[model samples]
Target: MNVLFLGKIQYALYRLVLAETPEAYLLQTHTLPSDLNFMPTLGNGHLGYTVFGDAIFMNGVYNGAGGNSKRARIPNWLNISAVVCDRFGCATDDDELSTTNDTLYEMDLRDGYFRYRKDYKKLGITLEQRSYPHKYFNRALVYEVVASRHATTARSNAPQFLKLSQHPGIASDAFEFVVLNNGSNAKGDYRVIRGRTQVLEFERFQPQPHEIYILFSQSLEEPLQIEWPTWQMEITHRIIICIDREQSVALKDLQDALELNFQDLHQKHIKRWHDFWDNDFSIRIAGNSLELWQIANAGIFYLASSLPSLTTNQKNEPFDGLSPTGLGRGNLEADYQGHSFWDTEIWMLPVVTQFGYDYAKEVLEYRSRKLEAAKYNAYAKGYKGARYPWESAYTGTEVTNPCCPEVAQQEIHISADISFALQKFFAQSADFDWTCDKAWPIAAEVAEFLVSRAACEELKQVCHFLNVMGPDEDHANVDDNVYTNAMAKIALEFAVWAGGMCGNASTELFEKWQQVSNRLLILRDVDLDYHPQHEGYKLNTEVKQADTILLGYPLRFDKSSTHLNDLKYYANATRESGPAMTWSMFAANYLRTSEDWRADEYFERGYKSYVRPEFKVWSETPIGYEGSANFLTGIGGFLQALIFGYGGLDFYRSGNQTTMENSGVLMPPNVEEVEINYIRYGDSKCRWIYKSHSSFMDCGYRKSGKKFEMLQGNKRTLLATNFNVTHRKGDPPIYINLMN
Candidate 1:
């Protein structure tokens, strides 16, 4: 869904009112005329006023009162009024409580066209407007009230009831009133009447016989005194007000700021939105509609603007997309709280990463810094090592509140997913050092936790990990959560490899890791040639649909590749599964050694039909859409399916025992294209063969004292960028038969 924003004009009013620290409440009364023909609801073809505030300041935009609040409202003549109040509503006489601060802000915003002009006059403020087609609204007069506060003696010595300060510390405050309307129209006349006296009047200006005239009034400002400390008390209150309008401010010793005439700022906002959409490079799709794209683009833009930059303090930021000012208010307090849950990492990060890798790295670093906390949290629960918080906030503490007090606490192994995410980031960016350092330790800790959690039935040669929740929030705290167990196994294996690669790892660490791996379990049904999600999965007739897609995602077992033929069986069983289940099936179909047409069929159904229409790719789908619709996990899997599934990039252990070879069991060698760049770490040595549909081409390059071979098909040429040719170390040089 497009990020719904509270209407712009109303939001502007709220910001203007809350501009100062001295909190204020703004209220207005609309009198239904006895004639019932006058003062129609302001928004609908009549007049209405709006209040905008920021921190401690407030402003208002005026429209003739006529439109209905419920139905529809778009005024022909627009003006603005403002006030700075103490609470939400508190005004007085002597210092006149009935008066309203007003400004004549004239504008017409319709059909992407707007024109606003204001002039300051002694009698009142005059406004003029002309829209895009040169459609002129002529002129209007608004009698406005000017409120000003002169010097006060309250600062002399604890004096309370003197004239109040305007900005408290600053000089006096001033308010200007103006009358606005069409010079000749009478149907739109209005007045701010306190009892029997009219405080302000709006008069319309026009030239023709058939012209219209509208009238409204402005309130004058009165000086009032507020309680203030006579002298210094080693204290200060700093208020930073962000305004919708652009105005200049002068702060004495303390800081005071203002933004007035902000029409240009609005233009800048729209321009930024446009720039983002312009830069979005999507491969041309066959049947794509511009309207659909606009909706998707707007949603993406809204998501980015609402979410904060991925810096440390800014993680898990939320914006009240549905509120005015689009600020984090209400439940939108999810902003600034830094609750970096799976939503940020799994659902949102892939999009951010595609746009900016640095942002993605910041999120990765945020998670890394929290690793120690995860470990301690796990230990607190009596788990052997780290168990990531199901919901992590700024403190890195588990925010996963259990279903009830009786349960004490919910099992949290989602940290396994966190480790999985780290691995994926490294694989995508080729950041080996990060993987070797930060990721390895945490992965190792999680593996340790899993080892303690795993149980074995030695007679049956079965191992099983249990007591965790899967992505499907509908079910919780179950055994062998396929998602969790698969991730744990992968985390364990990778951690072991990482530790061993360090060479100087302690024997204690290695032995502990071995114990964890040996206890790791996989439940298999030899007759069916497939694995179950968990021990009780078969007994859970209601949950029978969970095994296939849920089991398919982890790709934990080596034999999953051999189980692709059983998909139709799984699909037939899960025919009634929901979209979340369906999306998982699509991913599994893509990952396994399945037929291209069958995989594509599932992919289309899941992506185009099952998931939200708003989710066009792996990037836009949030976790709410799928169980674990996460950062790059799904996207990475999607990419892997494209490359490894269709391209068949599998590397199997060779019979020679010293090397791995492309099995060529899936995709045939002579088909499309394979171009790769390799970066070697440490003393590892390997050879790559690039084969094309036509003929084989071969070459090599050197960089930073390291050599890499470049192999191309005979029909294709090696197009190198920023590289120099070189020979592979200790390899037999071979000649290429070029067409030339």
Candidate 2:
């Protein structure tokens, strides 16, 4: 099925017109996917499950070894279906129930949910299946079934109770289910094919319930049924589907588990999602009816969904990292076995850090916690400091698929990318504690590795990183790949700055880093006045996605005419088959330059071919191509095109001061105005608004009593930025500086 399973969400119960929120649109699949597993997905960083909740993948829960190592697909605790019974008899769980197999699959972007409605025209009934991986409850997946019919329609043909049954017949030997005491609950454990133990606990209930009974199944392959004595019912099957990294969670008492209120819990989940889309951490574009708003919202939605909710870690659970597919794929090698790579830091981190503070912190924490493993990897590779793997899974070591040995050995830029991301976060966060405790250590080690890795020509004082692979994975064993060298330079400079800021300053080490970085080869095509992908890289040749152009944007390398030339050169050179993120980077690069027309062209090109029209979810490659779906890398890149490309902002740090510069703001040709509300410094939320020639910016804050304070002044002016941030809507071409 070439169908996409996500898009604008329309509520089945009430069509709400939300003010100041992205207006919801209806997204219908041309045809319902034969397998719900191919539909949209839900994840809370704890686990990722399919839309219908059949296959579930958990973080750090790999079951196998070698290239076959994959996330242990646990027994789905949330998979429950019903046979809507009326005068026509049971009308669900069978195709003949509905005259049309077509299902309306919509997502509630405001509340973070995946919902599909099917009308049984043959049987007088309409069914809505609404499910969400809880945004607040890190381990819970909430599934709702809305079955409705008039009581009069429940004639002699109808049973005494509405039928809502647990999906029967566990076919996989991996699952072992046991109906617990009283049959109201059950305990299920998935035995990893290689004998790993991952458990799932289920809690099923109805909000306005009168009477209910559960049919306990004897074995793993028995159909467990639940029937309620009501013609109309909204049954919510809430499962706390948390699987531990090294062990299984102790099964909770059935009484206490079932006692939880579904209504209250669901309201909390919706509220959290709503808060995310409020004026803070949101984007609005005037005169953009091309579904650009929906795509933007969906991109942010998918990225946020994959991460754990921002809350206290009362359970002290393990948070691995953001995978390429976010919470969309698990137990599948197609999504790279749920392993995190340079994608997290290089592609996704920019957007996450801008909006999600705690989530971005978690991304960095995964690397910090895995520092030992990174160091061990470096040691194994005959280097002096931490060397994060090109592919990292539960072990955090080199889990690079043995099939790609060259990438494992030569993609050394992964280390520098991590360090660069940390500093980027610090620029916006200014969390001295995190800088000292977490960021400093990681940055220091990566800088050390770069120093050891680079070979310098003493006479000319030039440094070359040999036997390296750039982002464009097509080439290998290249020296001083421009992107790699630039990132290494950023990492080294960040280490020097972070050390001084965090009391880890070493005069000798800092000087050495500066010397090496100053000389690192940023190879350029002198004739074309643009960067070459790497040493001996020929111009006008096919390269993979977004390589040399990265220097202009994220790395903030040379901003001279070379940057413009590099943008033009790489745009023609990048292959059509390049990953989905490629065009977005080119778009952002072009948007920042004088040629805004090209930016508009590439902006549409970024997603037109990559996004699945059905759900607006991104694929790693263009449609009809085999690549990861719900591709967060592409989603992140898409957001960058807006946040940086259209918003025209630079958030970076030099020495002790952090700065975010907004210059030459470019609006999409169709957009009259745009407002990007972002989180920066500590928790300050700032808004940048630009339309035509007018712009406004404010770093607003709340004081004691009831006073609200906006930054002293800035109309295309630089405001003295505060480390503690609290944002409110304002104008653009705005500059902010946080002075120590």
Best by lDDT: 2
Candidate 2, residues 295-387, lDDT tens digits: the string is 787788778778776652235365788889875575566778778899999899988887767778888889988888888888887888899
lDDT of 2 at 532: 83
Q: Across residues 1-740, which tens digit of lDDT does each residue of candidate 1 receive?
A: 23223334543464363232110111112222232111111110011112110111111111111110010111212222222233233233223323323423221111112222232222122222312110111011111222222233222332122222222122111112233321221542222211111111112211111111222211122343333233421111111111111111111100111121233323332333333333321111112333222222322433333232222111122221111111111111212122344545444444444434444565566667667776777777777878766544433555333333221243344666666666555544444566677777777787777776677677765566655555544455667765556666666766776677645467687676665566666556677666554556652233333343444433434436435634545565453444332443454455454354566555444344322222221222333332211122233333334334433333211111111112231222222333222212112211223332221212232233432223332332333323332223223222221110
For each candidate, give its TM-score against the true structure: 0.49, 0.85
Model 1 CA deviation exceeding 4 Å by range: 1-352, 402-412, 456-463, 472-478, 502-504, 539-562, 569-588, 604-740
Model 2, residue 469: C-alpha shift (Å): 0.5
lDDT for model 2 comes to: 0.68
Per-residue lDDT value at 621 in model 1: 35
